[model samples]
Target chain A: MADDQICPKCGAPLPADVAPGHCPKCLMQVGFESQDQAVADPAEAPTAVSGHSGVTWDLDQLASLFPELEIIKQVGIGGMGVVYQARQKQLDRFVAVKLVRPDLCDDPTFSERFTREARAMARLSHPAIINVFDFGQREQFYFFIMEFVDGTNLRQLMQSEGLDATQALAVVPQICEALQYAHDEGIVHRDIKPENILVDTKGRIKIADFGLAKLINPEATDFTLTGAKQVMGTPHYMAPEQLERPLEVDHRADIYSLGVVIYEMLTGELPLGRFSSPSEKVQIDVRLDEVVLRALQKEPEKRYQQVSGIKTDIEAVSASPTGHSPRQSVVPPTVRQAFNNLQYPGYGLYCVVNC
Target chain B: MDDAGFPSPHSGRFATTRWSIVQAAGVQATPNSRHALEELCATYWYPLYAYVRRRGYQADDAQDLTQSFVLSLLERNAVQRADPDRGRFRSFLLGSLNKFLSDETRKQGAQKRGGDRKILSINVDDVENRYQLEPTDDITPEAVFERRWALTVLDAALTRLQGDYERVGKLPLFEALRGHIGADKSTIPNREVAESLSMQEGAVKVAAHRLRQEYRDALRAEIAQTVTNSKELDDELTGLFQTLSGT
Candidate 1:
């Protein structure tokens, strides 16, 4: 601040020769001897700024941040933060902890938003969703402690050996089960691609990274808002409505994206442009065309109004037990009838029918 | 750049944020979107002008070149070459301005600036008056530009703070307490400000604390408009202080 004789307010080190008080840089008051001083509101500033600037945390800092957990191993990093697979000392259970990056820890809005996402995830009790073991702001970073599914994601599984129609029928319905619960609870997993769907070594389906999209959506929303004019998603899997009308995205957007996933899983292809139906891609039931096409519809209204609708159809297809031939007329008459007589949504009957 | 899929640095505030919008607009500003670019041009033209002047152009020539350079930059659609994601606005702007100067140098003589548009309303005498405040004979034009740019941004934040207080009918409070916006107040007791504002000493302390928080947020938001990524934010801030100190 040697030049701060310039003007601390504008970073303007205006000439010491200028008419003493006016900030030449921004044209504001400067250099006045007013006795008023600013006080720091300790409550508002969550962390002491002096301690917030390490590019990465040392192991000691991590240990100190979560004294209860043993920082076991680094899991993976996403567009948002780093994930570590740690053991919860008291529970003696392994959990995946995602920590917001050091640079972002200083942003109050981001911290608040992270807390909101954690709160949203905490509200759901579904087993299919990644369970929140613990979450809070500590030290400088916000960490989400989640149930670490000790299984490969569906993306890895698909890479090793693509899911067959029957296998997809088993897995996708489970995904639908998770999404249905989240959607019913007024949550939308805006980014629903194969990458987000994780499969355990034991064939358990866990929807990992629920609120990770909110922070990452900064990039996507930027593109959507700016000239890139591109929507943020695997374009092949994104619902057309998402790109065409971004702000109007709702729960159905998830359903539409899930439909794309089903199409990818069943046919090993995205439902892009006059895409051949899943049955056409492989030897699956033609009735699935009705379900997949409906879910992948360009119009939001034309798609499954509820995620349970897709779950119900997939469950019905799986339940038919091969060659039942539940009528080629697969398109349901109404949104209500599509999920007709489905009580309690995708929780019980959906799982039982698929199981 | 790790295993789970975290993109480096996260770009933090958002691309939909003001600076991002300006970056996007700079790339391909349509007639309709040109206003956003112009607004940015208006805010930053001063530093670039100061940079040109310090580079040894006479006052009239500097003003003419700066206006023409900014207009021609947009008019010729040259700034569209900058990738907002890959670079910072200040760097991109200074680089472009430097290029413009070198090009102008080669061409020689004053280039004709259009009188039709007046895109950046730079008051010549006011700018010249402001230019007089810059220390002489020690800093490079680049360093001067950086210093001025930092000050301009700081000024924007201060102006915003002033406007906020003015809007809330607390301009006097802002004027009275503005001197110690971030400085230690131990020398000047809270009793002094309390006496002036006619409030309790404790209330003055609370008010001062809130002002500090508000000013910090304002500064952050202002700096946010300059940097696109969280990584660049720290660098820009460090550079801001260094440039101001004429480093």
Candidate 2:
């Protein structure tokens, strides 16, 4: 009888006949979570343990996993690991460091591939490509450090609304330049969707996360990094060859994907079948019709053979005035068949987009 | 030192546990009330000791610094001024120790910090050997405090549970299943435990369940002492479990 009188929290004697829920002292203490205000008696506390089990799940464990880097905040999480906004204390530089999940690097072959790919990316120092600063092992996890871009990815920018025509024009040329630079280095960005492109606060467009998808299987990784959910629409942007014979895809695959990105940016709709050119969807300069169509060709060999060619065509298109009709181009039968072979449920995606 | 000299905390006087004692005693602690205050210091001081050591102070300096800080706390009656309803006692102690450490630095290092050279008896000679056993990874002061407090609670729960099992003459049963406590079903063959404890495999599983339930109860009681309310107990335990699993 005396035991019922004591407070469970502070261990003080409970004031006789106080209301059941509020711990007049402590639960009423914090203007914290609303649950504290409600006073659901913890009398069934143990039965609640099963639901509360994941409380230990968080990125706070990164303190030891990465000792050199003080994680400022989590920038984003992907299949590989997590991208943390960190201060490299030894260097005193703010960096966007991406740490892959330990499970992803469990294979020795994949580890070697990661190193080789990261090394190739590290050497690529282009103003239009996200500058890879350093990369190596940090405990059981492998990390890639790059210059943190202070901006949103193109997918977020376009998804929120749509980009202005000139803004879209400004972004695509730099993307062409970055892909051209990567192609010159013999590193093809296998996944070159709009999600991989970033536009910084200054409107400086830079291609982001190249060589990531090729080094590791996107299906086996985090949804955040693989863009798996958003990538339901990936088939809409993927080149035909990349979809049909993925292993044989080369740098031209990037050009094909970039064309899809440009097509979507101008129209706010994907460049699926029965679709008009970029100029038809929105009033963009008409000269872009051939440049975008050629890049969207059914075969990689037929698409602009090099990104430099795409860059040249984009620059030429930019020079021409707006409001003119693009010359007629024949519709290819193979491009539609290739679109279905993309292995994504993009039919629903385009249905939603078109509707 | 072990808590043997103090009154058993679980003996119904837990109504006068550290937090309640501070609230009951108020700011003007009398000569008679010093016993409860000392008991409070006895149960909680080690976590603070571990904290000072982690702040990069060497053995002798950390000991002297902690001893002096505790002495200074007693001299100032910092506990009496603590608002019992505001937060957990563990948080209050940590806050006070942090303030003391910051103030001590401003006043300069280890110079006669022991007020009137009072003997607090922290057993720092064994502290370094114990500290060396802690995980040697980069951790912030805040994390170290949380970790040490959680560890203290776990250790206390374990010791109390071990005592309970011993008193029941089931010490062997407790020890045989101790290793299996952290093991999953696949890792722990109920067969091995059954054969060793000389019982049916089903009884062994039941014994494991009982031990686990008892351990959970001990842990809850242990956690209940330091926190302000029952709601905060799980949050504190979660913090502890996270630290223990970090390695």
Candidate 3:
């Protein structure tokens, strides 16, 4: 009878005939699967078919391939490849073995690039980063032996017991430390989402899959491989430049993604299409909104120049007491100076004394 | 599997749906089984009517054909031919209807056969009025049936949710928060609703989230009734979403 109204959730035009008061598409999607299951669509991440021989490997076959380790079982399957938990015979410890998808290795120069990037990843040694033990091409399979994280990922944590403002505050700084460490080593983690961030039982954050994005898909310009329906990285966490001008994306893109992760952790929602500030959505310090908003800035130049800056700002906010009014005069010049001094390791301690 | 004859393992909310009851009854139609089928037919008759109309039938002829087909299905034990293993009610209905339509010998005789036996209480004017608003895109009759079926399923689920809220005397709250059924609550203005209902903003957010969870369970329950088991429920839902979004 009238022009069709648009659905706010999915942006699809609601059918004119059926006035169900809710978006029919989204409603059908709700019936499709629970929120958690839909996020990891099985179609996108198929079970791994090991090697280029088109033969699916059983545990025995996988164990035979890697004689040095006891192949436990398949732990995870991503667009990149499969991850298997195994114990190194010589080292007598658990390690995650990541196999590069055989299809990805079809590129002629893949071996050279993989070796180069894998070395860089191996060189990165930080508590907040998953340690890369060994990487090499074993037969047709390019594998990476990494430190196994014996805990759930950030995505699972957020889905199960949603993070409160306090828990989110603690998690952000650790992510910043890990990201900053990798960034300084001249390796940019093109894909930095909650799924890649692992949290152990002791509540320690470890960022995984550093430089693997570049190693998998060398051309950053082709962000989403829509032809294969294989998303390189979660688009919601991607910076504007990653989607628009992918070639120019630098370490700041990782900062933008970290901003998205922080916002999602705080509010349990993606900051999509004129979203409200995190403080407005949840009970948090109002000043922390500035840090989130700046990191989420559309232009790369406007965001935090370094990943450590996000940590400094978050730490500064955590150091101060809550319920303080948002006034420029409230933050003393000493605290403002601490903001400029990005490399100050004890900025939070300094803020506690001064402001 | 037991003295009851119906599968016993399917317990709790999924124990005995109308389709499952009819499937369990097989060719022998008991009174209880017959009543369950009738109730299901009444709820889902519109999609069949829409499908008939989309297949190039005129208003009066399409109405007669759908009614006659449904009558034959109810009275003649036609569901006996529906494969017991393929337990999806939607697929069985579509297949049986197609078979009935394709039989030229029975088609002419079945038309205007059940003029006095109107078991379903479907409003003719209202049904045609809704059909007129159907998109005139170049979609097949099967696609039309599927999309209409998906809408009908969601409508039934929403109506059930509304009825639940109504019984608890929370219809006003349901009305205010219905728009957020499948939406992210954070993106919506909970404070506005909170002030209007004189509720704490946090309490309103919790209420909204609970409503969404309830709505999801209701929709799942509705879908669960159509398929044979819990496993097929997700597959059926995925199919419904694809059908609706494809158009």
User: What are the per-model DockQ values?
Assistant: 0.04, 0.02, 0.14
lDDT of 2 by residue, A21-73 (tens): 22223222221111110012221011101111111213456666677877665
Docking class of 2: incorrect
Worst 10 residues of 1 chain A by lDDT: A37-46
Roughly what TM-score does model 3 have, to 2 decimal places? 0.49
CAPRI-style docking class of model 1 based on DockQ: incorrect
TM-score of chain B of each: 0.85, 0.79, 0.91
Which residue runs does candidate 1 get wrong by more than 4 Å? A1-54, A57-61, A102-108, A218-234, A321-355, B1-247
lDDT of 2 by residue, B25-90 (tens): 666776644565565566666777778888888777677777777666666677765766656777
Which clashing pairs does model 3 show? none
Residue A122, candidate 3: C-alpha displacement in angstroms: 0.4
lDDT of each: 0.63, 0.60, 0.74
Q: Against the true structure, whose DockQ is highest?
A: 3
Highest TM-score scorer: 3
State which candidate has the highest lDDT.
3
Clashes of 1: 13
CA RMSD of each candidate after superposition: 24.7, 24.0, 16.4
**Candidate 3: where is the Cα deviation over 4 Å?**
A1-39, A42-55, A220-231, A324-355, B1-247
Q: Which ranges in model 2 have alpha carbons more than 4 Å from their true place?
A: A1-57, A218-234, A324-355, B1-247
* lDDT measured at residue A83 in model 1 versus the true structure, 0 to 100: 75
Backbone clashes, each candidate: 13, 9, 0
